[model samples]
Target chain A: MTRQFLRHGWTAGLLAILALLFVFTKIIQPDFGTSGLDSLSRAMLPFAFATAAMAVVVIAGGIDLSVASMMAVAGVTAAVLMDGAGDGMTAVAVVIVLLVGLTMGAINGALIVITRVPDIVVTLAMLYVWEGVALLILNGPGGSATPWLRELIVGPFIVPWLPRSLVFLAVCLVAVWVPLKRSKLGLSIYAIGSNDLAAYRSGVSVGRTRIAAYAVCGLFAAIGGLTLTMSTGNGEPIPGPYLMASVAAVVLGGVVLGGGKGALLGPIIAVIILRLVRMDLTLLSVDPNVTTIVEGTIMVVVVMFGGVLAYRGRHK
Target chain B: MTSETTMFKSVGRFIGNNPLVPLLILLLVLVGVLEFMRPGIVNERWIGNTIKFAIPLAMLAACQTLTMLTGGIDLSAAVAATISAFVMATQVPIVGVPLAICIGLIPAIMIGMVNGFGVAVCRVHPLIMTLGTGLIATGCLQVYQRFVIASGSVIPDGLAWLGTGRTWGLPNALILFVPIAILIIWAQRRTGFGRLLYALGSNETASRISGVRSWQVFLALYMLSGLIAGVTGLLYVGLIKAPSLSLVNPLLLPSVAAAVIGGTSIFGGRGGYSGTILGALILTVLGTLLTLLQMPEGLRRILFGLIILTVTTTYIRLTEQSR
Candidate 1:
């Protein structure tokens, strides 16, 4: 276990960077310990979920460009249902939105597998389709989440100091990621991602594993959408920026885009780091335009660092 | 009966040998359908307009095709083009048109060189590398908008003439596209660099072992993509007259879709620009038809997505069967 942890040292490095950023933020804004922490958690939650969604697909040796679009679709669906139906239908609305996400993801997987098309191409096409569907559902993006639904998702849980988003994230780690990590399917996903041909030769069902990965990706994306709706109490059809941001986060998290590497912890920490950077920029009163430049620079730097590490490992 | 069977077999063989044949046929069929649906579309003015709109897309598709031919992609192509346009539009007032155009293209080429260096030297994935560069380009545009140049600047008369002016009753953009197309076709068919790209994309290790300078070829291809994007952006500014940051943003996906629809393999090593030309024409006509039908924006996007998906899948299946 120690050897494995050492092998994936980037995750540790990222966690340290995240800690530093937190400390720095606290230093810059001394009162950041109060309401700032809650807002920070709320801002980090959606992107954390998005990074996890991309990580699952990347681990299965696939890329889903449609994830942000899926989030938008889910968010809009939840909002529309909540607004149209009464408070009593919140649970049903949540279930239906999740199903929508699953269906979209499954469609992405099915198209790629059945047609023998590249994952990027299939998902790129689906990105457009989902974006269109989101726009069609809510042409102008005017819907509200139920007050109770918002309270359940973002309201304080158990104690005033404990934000609900943090609790939700912890539950995800314990209930979803940990169990999935140990399951046969999860192992199969990693196997396929590492080398699908080899896995197929060894009696692993590559198709099934890939489909499951996409389904899980969709599920997480829906969760992200739900969180976004709760935090903002609204929905937006345009998700192009979020799509790129999630990909950036996934890459920054030390997850190889080619797949079969990295851990969930890395991406979670990476998301927090990214959120903190944005917060810092805002606190510093930097121009919003510089934010894109910073994010892009970070993505390139992380990718180049990974590239150098891989090259060194290969040469050695 | 045997002779007829042999004839049919030969025809199939011919199409399988030349991928562009079916694409050309499809383009013609689409044009015919459009003409039938809207008689006015058959006129020279309409044809000229369609060709004009297709010119920049075709060039962008060509950019995509060149990169794909070398087993890579440039998601920053549109952004590069937009930046080039922004530079030219902003500088034309101060400097003359010729100097401004040259200045604009320099940074565009630089963007490509950077992308190439990352993909070749650093060995980063093309998707992520280009995406990062694209983000950087967008950021630059945002900064430029906020600080340097005012938004919605008009194109100079000289540039505008290049965009919409006619030469011998043919649209100037179309006139420009023909020579560029011819040059690319000639290069791909007859140039050593072109053959190296195909070989490198086909099997990098084999080509490397056989003395192909892989890095040089990658750099050249990426630089060429950037140069083409820059030129396309200038033409796009001419077409639109006002070049804003978002002016050419929508072209990014369509350029990729055009290349794929043209039967250029995304995995690389198996396609050409001839099909891409037809692909651009098809999309331009499809856009015209969609507009004529007066569809809602959402519905139009959905249809565009469906067409891309269906066409790409069909092309892949057909090629696989042929192989």
Candidate 2:
């Protein structure tokens, strides 16, 4: 039991944080269990997917500043395609949006590899380009959340205690994340991120791993975009500022920034904690801006504590 | 044939040795293009206006270039600038302008100190520390605004004059800019502190092994970045004649772009600010060209992003081959 608990490491701490926030929120709202959690889960889907996207890219030793931009593109693309489409076309539109996102991600990876530019620089530029693409696609927002998509996403609870959003979240984890975590691609990602030169010497093909990482990121970002579209009932032109929030959550989740270590689930939990922080502030009727301050403080202070722990472990 | 080959080789060597020359040439070419597109647009007045707009941008970018020298970035630079400008503007009506400005700058310095402490003493990544601090500062500003919004803000007269006034075909801001520019350039080349930044960026472990207190350098460096950002903010408010919550937020990415375009390597230990100055001018010119076309905002941004990518890619390729 002790060994297993030790193996869990930061995940345990993250869960503790999540639980603390949950209880605090529960206190703030007596009706928090059923309706509150359902709405929160609905709100969380986009961020969860985005967090997964960021986790994949960061684990591969690269940062994708364009994740939010990619989501905007995907969201707007789907919004445009699904506009007044029937059920069949709506499904097809979803597939096309996924493909569009994957293609964009592939292009980012190729550009980074071929240009030999730093990932941050490449992604930063792409952030602008993709945002432009999003604006062009949906110039003034609107056009999303068709009846089918709305029902499919948010209509009825599939299970007694669970939300449809959580169900979709589980599907993504079980169907996509777990398999990726177990695959050769996952191993390659860790290899390159930890030490690319050594990995190259040992025949890991750093370029391919990076491309795969970003491609996966693009797909997940598309999922986030889709969820956002359905949940909000329209596409927004602005790439929401999920990039920093996602990064903060990633760090708080114990995904080492220089890369190569972390669980995908850790960030998902951290996202909930972050959302709860906002929820708590909202419930308290304080200024909306304090939420950002608390979140930023939490991220920095948590990371600092972790750093101190690591330093001590090193000395020991 | 031998003479031609030697001439080509010598030209390549000259470019490789002084990378700033090509960037300067590019700026001139961009100015010429803008002139061709609109005719009579690249005159003394045009020069004055372009330099005026580019001044705040380049000053803000100094925060980036200086930090990039040490393989770190001050992501909070924009936020610090916004806070300074907003605070100074709001407080000017209550306290006198000079005192308001000084008080406004204190937050930026405190942010800088926190960034320094987090990054240097706590060993947090500079990106994370500045980002966190930037958010905190923004939050604090919002809190401050709640109280001050009832009172309203007034832009300072001296700043307004410095931002918009012209004297003998030159921007009045130049009076302030010339000394700042000279000091930055001179310090980058002449100061021991500048050499220390290069040394630390090149090899932090090696520098520490040689007894350089890395923390001291980082604390000073980040604090300086914060100070520059704060001053740029104050100047920017004067130029735009507006103070909002996100007054300088838009400059954050462009400042990074300017530094990178000037050939400052993001990974650190290479490049200089002279090229960055040219890069800022080129970007301003490009923005002007895009506005002249009068395309949709979306198309404008697309072209803008495309142009920046093409320029940086081409510039990097050119510099790489020369070396």
Candidate 3:
């Protein structure tokens, strides 16, 4: 319906703006274009996975603030595992990263369900805990991945223009999208997020669905972490704060903070918009420190606009 | 049942019922652990300086807690503090220190009013509205000071002495915080406005239905937060004697952590200032202990983040278990 399209007009508009800025940045900062685009693609890939992961949770009416932190956990775990093992151990390490993400997310979901604490608190606490665990494990930063494993996983390829990270992200999106659009599990997730009580009454497995959503969130965060390590060629503990930024991005992307509104495209667009803002700030020669203020302001404004629109739509 | 028996039973129930008793006990245990970790950490100098360092955060927490108590957050406290710091830095020598401090308080209060108006009158979510105010305040400071104020600049000896002065082995800031705390506690417990806030926080619709002027109360609470943030800025001037924009963002979380850790429910209502003060002490002491241990910055960050997570998770678990 045209009404449905109108409902998502803000998202479409933001995506267009982002596309323009991407080109504009390319024109203005052509020197850093290849590297920046590479970096953006690399950086955006993981968050893209996170966005997909967050999409499900949001559809279920929960927000996952622990994605970035969980990503750190997975990345650190993967790197640490790779460092300790022989060349043959890379596949095993990758599997372990996925498992850790699922476990962490499961804990998040279980806590949220059992305690009835707000998702914000649950996710915030997890963000800190996982980051600490990452720090505890990594000790500092820069865990080494096996050279061959790194080559295969993160190395540049000739056949396709797409980076491995891009392929990984695309695969994740397909993996999530196909099941989500086609499966009963996806419907259950939406049902639970929209109204837990209603979903429960309707015989949906609220606890299992929420747990699954969180597990998926964790899995995505890991993929993001791996992508980040591959791009940076080093692990930096600093991106710990970005977990919240990712959440803000998701919210800005048009995903409703309270769970069951918005689409995958919204957060993907939101991330691009945020990246564009950062790129613009860089173009303007603004102090990087001030970027925090700008990013926070943008997030708050976007959420406020979303809130107002939601309020109006309901009342109207 | 006889009246005497019923009275005895009620008294027994009251003895067992207060939430503050358990919270206080928990706080004491945590403080004890910190003291044990650092031998003589509770010594006179350590105690004095910790309280002194905690004063600005405590004051900010008091104001922030008041807003949170009203079902809103005051994100502009840090910015208001920066603005006040900027005013004190620029104006202290021009206008005498006393007048300068008074001038510093003005913008903070005004900023608070703006937050109140936006949220209460404009119907903006407190998070978004205050964030906007925070940006404006940050910009005002950034633009006014041109990014950084020079360190160790001359301030009035009299004002600097107030910052450095001690009474009963307590830094003036710490001593100053006590009376403010007392006054706040009095205001919260005895005043009509305080009751109005609790009423509003517990249920806005019920309060609105009951004829409480919720908007005016909201405005006052937010304005009060700004006033406190201004005071915090003035204290920072005395302590550091420079307005550093770097201090603004860091203070925001620690203040929230102090308020929340001290048993102020993020949901609003069911809390008091004493808890926030205790929470401030806990955080200040934790920082002191980490520094005394000579922990690296990264490690300290890791520890701080872990401790906050641990405390918050424990709080969540405890609250959930109780329910």
Candidate 4:
């Protein structure tokens, strides 16, 4: 029972802190009531999807540092394709955008499985290779996402109260979390993450499962990337920082780096909390530098705590 | 059995066992292709200058190989290099050039120590820990750049010569390469430290059980990696004669890639610096050839990605086949 409590405690703690931050920010900055919430949601919405994508891979016991790069590549691909489509092929280009995302994801998954390289190294390499590829494609093309597409991505959903991107975000959460409950593949992922050799003994195809997990991660990243393109309406050369931010979200969300243990919703909240951290810092007029320091301190401390947890768990 | 015949067998065995052979073959292949496309591409000037450009990267790859050998990756190597470059450039004018170079090693050693402590003593994973340090280093870069702005600083002309100046028709950068390569080779083949690294890489648990002090080895390896990155960064700054932060982007990929292709197992254990140097040379030549081919940067990148994917796959397949 106590173990379960500790398991849930990571997410609960972040939630509590998030609530405090939101409330405090609201109180201090009178302007934060509605617009702040909107900004908060706006800032977090795309990352929310990205975090979900990160969570799937993390839960499977691998890390995808390339999520940001995939997002960048996919986003740029979609934008450039849309731009080049010349109005007649806009719909076809959108389909192409999603397809390119899938292709990129497959590449990531394929490379990880075949090379058997550490996920970090493989993904870090992919992050560069893909981003370089994206930059080369864009090549200072200076394209923009369409107005309608931007509106669909940025505007409110049917409720007219929540962001439109929140709809896709909802679909993403359901798509992942639902299957996680229903599918043996999901359980096997958790098993593989916990102990791959043991999982292999238990009749799971570790390589296939891992590849699938990375593909799903790629898919999520691509989706996130396309959404971000629609929201921002531009392609970017530098996508690593934002990608690292998502990585920070995954780690902060209590997904253990070596894999096999973490909740889905935790990363979502982590993304929000991280965005809020930035928002709160901005609200309080704290130096953004302090935020970096705080973030680094938090990552090092959390990773240490995770080590402690794993150490104690092992001994126990 | 005759000693000469026995020696021949050992020499053949070493060639067969060494990772450098494959990388050398790759380099030869690259030269062949470049020559095929444009004859005399491997002329004395081209070869010497290529080696000069290749040295800083090769040094960095050697450091990366050592860290990766111990089952850790040093993402901060580039940042370390960048910081060192910035520091060297900034300090050389204030202090004497030689003194500036020596002082610059301090930051690299310190960053390395921090990485070592965090991973060894703190028990933090190298990735997260170095990432934090990497970020801190990046911030320091920004801070130092701001300092440069405030102080109106510039790297000294004499120090800049370390990058550009040549000796006996050979670039000074190439001079830095030989000693570093010798030291890396010595560390790997002629030392207890190399054995400890191999043992740690092969089996950390057994190595620890056998009293190898795996953590200490890790600490030392990380420190070495950092120190090497620092020197590499200095060389880079000297070469460019300015601290270009963008260099980190290209450096990170190729450094890690060179180590991998040079036949260093990314999983750690079972590789050498000789292969890393050869790998760096091959990759540098490949990139240069791509430019020479007049390929658009985009096509070149796509091709580079394909090459990486192909190389890693081939490396894995070859190992599997051997097993």
Candidate 5:
């Protein structure tokens, strides 16, 4: 039990920090109740999903610079279709947008494999490509989502205490992450990430695992996009800011950037903490620019701290 | 096979071994296409304009090329450039142009040194380290803008002339690029430090074992990257005739893309400024062509993305095949 606790100490520490921030926000704003929590969840869902998407890719020893762009593409596609096809076709529109995200991810994966190029290079290029596609789909961010879709995504849950966004996140955790993390494919991803040549020698399918990781990442990115569309009721062609936010969340979550280590829980907690910190700052009437500075500082500090920990552990 | 077939095979081999061949071919093709699109794109005025626009990017790409050669990257490069430009613009009023320009380099140099310390001494990944510093720089700039620097400060006339003025039928920026290019090429080929950089980049452990101080090399390279970014920012202010926060934001990714397209492997080692120069030119030409076609911004971005993808993939495949 102690070994297990120590093993996940970083994640535990993050959870504690999140709890502290939550309490701090509530203390600062006494009116911050269920309604405030609901809005916070709604605002955080996209970034939480994005962090998860990035975590998966990073764990697979690749980084996807296009995740935010994928979100934009998916959001724009859904928004345009929802606006044009009406509420009756919401399901079909979502399916198509999800397919778009998957296709984009597959293209990234295929290009990385076929060209033998670095993941960063391939994804960076795709980031621009998808952003362009998003802009092409919605030139100025005017498309709207159907009310039904919005309710389905961002509405309160059937149970009064739970928000739909939280429910959705829980579902994702239970349905996708829990199962995938214990699966053969997941193990293969870890193996390949830690050392691709060794994994290949040991009969793991490095290429396929990498592609699958990216596909999963894309699926989550699409979810993030849908959530953004639902919450905002519109599509934003420029989703560049979310890219850094997602990365920051991943780092804060205790995920190793070099690959082969990390859990989904860290990023989820990190996301909430990040949002709560913003909420706290807003309640305190801090400057908006300070938010970016704080976020960046946290990212650096967490990464540096992690580096030190890893170094000490190795040497010790 | 006949002798003719053998000759063809050898020629194919030659092209395969040399990464620059395809880049040159691509450049020629782009030039031809641009000329076709606009009947007089081949003329001096247009070409000069293209090179003029490319100069900043070329310099930025050179900065990227240096760090990339050392297996590191500077995501904050554009921000670093912006900070320097902001400093120069704000300080020129108080300190005059020459001293302000010299003072402007301080922030860039300091930031680069900090990035070097983090990466070389602390062993943080370059991406995260530079990103953190970049955020700090940007935040500081925001604070500076909000509190200190008044808006609407014009660039000094001397610097503006160097930026826009031509000498002996060449754009001054281009003229400046000549010495910068020559210096980099010469340093890379002739200096002991240059050899150490390649050695450290190619195999850090081996180099460490063989008496190369990897940290020193990393420090120097990162510092050089910062200095170049500072110089690029100064020139950029001249070119744009003002310093804005977002002045060099768009160039960040393009600079990295240019370095990659120029055959600088992002992983480290095995690339040069010469290739980056060509890459910058090609990108400038592409941008010019896109504008001449009056393509919408969305389509233009999509085209640029596609070009980066296609060119990079082709180059990677060619190199893999040759190997």
Candidate 6:
């Protein structure tokens, strides 16, 4: 038990920090309650989903610069489909949206494999392409889902302070990712990420695994988009702010940027911590510009500290 | 029909052998198309203008080429460039042009050094390190802007002349660019640092075993990339004559694309500045073609994505087939 605790020490540490951050938030803003928690969770949804999307790709030894763009496209498509819809329509729209996202990811994967171009270059271009497609789908922002649909996504769950979106996230994690993470495909993802040539030699289909990883990323990005749209009651084609932030979050999550190692919980906590920091700044009435600096500084400082710790660990 | 088929294959063989031929041919074809669309648009002055614009992009792509050569990337380059340009533009009123320009560059150099430290000493991946540093630079720039926003900016007379002026039917940028271009191309081939970059990029373990100090190479490499990005920023601000928060951020993607299109594989180890130079020119020409087509903004963007993917894939396939 003690050895297991030590092995997973960082997990506990990160959760503790999150708890501390919550306490700190409560102290500063006295009115902060279930309502605040609810809003905060809702606000973090898109990025949390994006962080998940990016993490999967990173762990598979590839980076998808177009994930945010995919999110935008999915959001717009959902908004278009679910708006002014009848009963059972929103569900159908959602399924279609997921399909759209999956197709997009498959196309991205196909392009990468067929062209033999680097993932960064291909996805970088795809990012712009999808962004344009989002705009083409809806010339301007003005699209919204039905009231019930919106309620279903961002509304309170069993209790007032608990959002359905958060619940949805938890269920999805258990229902989808856990099982996938233990599957052969998942192991192959890690293998290719760690060393593709060796994995290929060992009978892992590197291309197929990479494509599957990206496809999974797409499905999550679609969920992120739908939730963002529902929460805001509108959809805009502009790329969500999480595009680059997802990369930062994934790295902070202890995912090696070169690939093959990480956990979902680290990024989840990192996302919360990042959000809390921003929230704290707002509550403290710091200048918006200073907030940017603080956020950036925190990212760098934490990583540098982590690096030092790892170095010491190696030496020890 | 058989004769024609043989001729086609031989032409393919010719193009595959000369890697730069495709990019150069595409550039000429695009220019020709533009000319065909609207006669007399391909005059010497217009040619000079295209080169003028291509120079900054080429400079930025140089950062990508060099860094990607080392199996890393500098994502913060655009941000660093923006910070330098913004700070320098704002500092012009108080510090004068040259000193302000130098002052503008300090932030970029510092950012580069930090990026280098993180990637080299801390072992942070260059992508993340550069991205983090880039964000920090932007944040710092925002804070710096508060104090300097009131002071009106002045474009250095020299930069404006270099960015916009023409000398004897050629862009005045050539004076500065020629030496810089020659230096980058020549150094990449001849300099010890250049060889180290390729070596480190292609095989870090082997290079390390061969007694190469990998970290030192990264430090110098990132710092140099920062300096290059900084210079590009200065020149870009001069070109646009307007300094915004995102002066060079927009070019970030294009520069990476240009490097890729020019045949600098993002995975590293094989590519050169000469190709990147042509890549920059080709992109500049392509931009002109898009604008002339006058397509909708979204369509243009989609077209750009398709073009990049198709061209790169075809180029790689052709090159691979030749081998």
Candidate lDDT scores, in order, read: 0.85, 0.87, 0.73, 0.76, 0.85, 0.86
Docking model 3 quality class: acceptable
Q: Estimate each model's TM-score.
A: 0.96, 0.97, 0.83, 0.91, 0.94, 0.94
Better of 2 and 5 by lDDT: 2
Kindly list the per-residue Cα lDDT of model 2 for residues A1-316, writing each as its tens digit.
Answer: 8888866778998898788888888787887776677788888888888888999899989999999989998998888888889889998999999999888888898888888888888888888889888988888888966786776656337565677778778887678888888998889999888999998999899998899899999999998999889888888879897898889888888888888888798888899888888888999997898877887898889888888787777779
- TM-score of candidate 2 restricted to chain B? 0.95
Higher DockQ: candidate 1 or 3?
1
For model 1, the stretches where C-alpha displacement exceeds 4 angstroms are: A153-161, B1-7, B150-154
- Fraction of native A-B contacts kept, per candidate: 0.61, 0.60, 0.15, 0.33, 0.57, 0.65
lDDT of 4 by residue, B1-323 (tens): 69999999888777666546656777898899999999876787887788878888888888778887777788788888887777766776688677877877888888888888888866777877788777766766665565566544477676567688887778877667788889888988889999788777788889889888777887888898889998888888777775765554468768888888778887677788887888888888988887887766666766776676667667656655544
Off by over 4 Å in 3: A22-36, A43-59, A63-68, A84-87, A146-167, A177-182, A284-297, B1-12, B15-17, B31-43, B90-114, B121-124, B128-164, B209-220, B240-243, B285-323
On residues B1-323, what C-alpha lDDT tens digit does candidate 3 reach at each position? 69999999887665344445555676677668778886666778766777777887888888768877877778788888878877766776567667877887898899998788777665666755786778656756665565335433345665566566778897876567778899998998899998888888789989999999877888888888888888777777677765566555567767877877776776777577887887787788777666777755546766776576567667656655554
Q: Is the docking of candidate 2 incorrect, acceptable, medium or high quality?
A: medium
What does the lDDT read for residue A122 in candidate 1?
A: 81
The stretch of ten residues in a row with the least summed lDDT in candidate 4 chain B is B144-153
**Candidate 3 has which clashing residue pairs, if any?**
A46-A224, A60-A193, A61-A259, A253-A266
TM-score of chain A of each: 0.95, 0.96, 0.86, 0.88, 0.95, 0.94
Q: TM for chain B in all models?
A: 0.94, 0.95, 0.87, 0.91, 0.93, 0.94
Question: Relative to the unseen true structure, what is the C-alpha lDDT of residue B220 in candidate 2, on a scale of 0 to 100?
Answer: 96
Candidate 2 residue A264 Cα shift, in angstroms, is 0.7
Model 5 Cα RMSD, 1 decimal: 2.5
- The DockQ scores of all candidates, in the order shown, are 0.70, 0.71, 0.24, 0.48, 0.61, 0.65
Quick one: best TM-score, which candidate? 2
TM-score of chain A of 2: 0.96
lDDT of candidate 1 over B92-125, digit per residue (tens) = 7778678989988988899999899888888888
- Predicted candidate 6 versus true structure: per-residue lDDT over B29-92, tens digit per residue: 8888999998999999899999999999999999999999988888888988888888888898
Segments of candidate 6 deviating more than 4 angstroms:
A1-3, A308-316, B1-18
The residue-level lDDT of candidate 3 at B167 comes to: 80
Superposed by TM-score, candidate 5 places the C-alpha of residue A98 at a distance from the truth, in angstroms, of 1.8
